[model samples]
Target: MKQHLKRTAEYRISNRRMSKSGIASLSHFLYIRQNSLFDIRCWTFDVRRSLISFSILPG
Candidate 1:
């Protein structure tokens, strides 16, 4: 019974530590994802605007 209790306590401590790190990494991943998506949106918008300008100039 004592060994079982000790093992459970150790497991709980490790789980808590892992959860904190997991949350940090998950948030970091989301931040990077959001920035990349924003960059892609701006790039596409710029490309479309330049294409429109070029087409207008030719006509």
Candidate 2:
């Protein structure tokens, strides 16, 4: 009975570790995506500003 309990406890610990790792990976992916989205937003804003400036200037 004691050995069974020990094995169960070990399994639980390993399962928890695996879940934590999965969460870490998910958060890392989200971080990367957030940064890329920010970059895209900045790039678009710059393009819009340049377009406006070009329109205002004489051809």
Candidate 3:
């Protein structure tokens, strides 16, 4: 799964750009641990850098 996220992140980095990259760059911020939960704290930082706009997703 980590490999998958890395691949997806790599792909997003190459294909997606600022503002729209967030959706694709989800791989970079997503986390699924042994506790079985996805945590996304990078949203604030990413948004400030124009790397993504998670406003569309559930808040």
Clashing pairs in 1: none
Across 1-59, the per-residue lDDT of candidate 3 in tens digits comes to 99999999988877766647776566555533422441344655566666434454545
Model 1: ten consecutive residues of lowest lDDT: 49-58
What tens-digit string does per-residue lDDT give for candidate 2 at 1-59?
99999999999999999999999999999999999999999999999999999999976
RMSD of model 1, in Å?
Answer: 2.0
What lDDT tens digits, residue by residue, belong to model 1 across residues 1-59? Answer: 99999999999999999999999999999999999999999999999999999999989
Clashes of 2: 0
Q: Report the number of clashing residue pairs per model.
A: 0, 0, 0
Over 4 Å off, model 3: 17-59
Best by TM-score: 1
lDDT of each: 1.00, 0.99, 0.60
**True-structure lDDT of candidate 1:** 1.00
Model 1 bad stretches (over 4 Å): 1-10
Candidates ranked by TM-score, best first?
1, 2, 3
Which residue pairs does candidate 3 place in steric collision? Answer: none
How many Å off is the CA of 55 in candidate 2? 3.7
TM-score to native of every candidate shown: 0.71, 0.70, 0.27
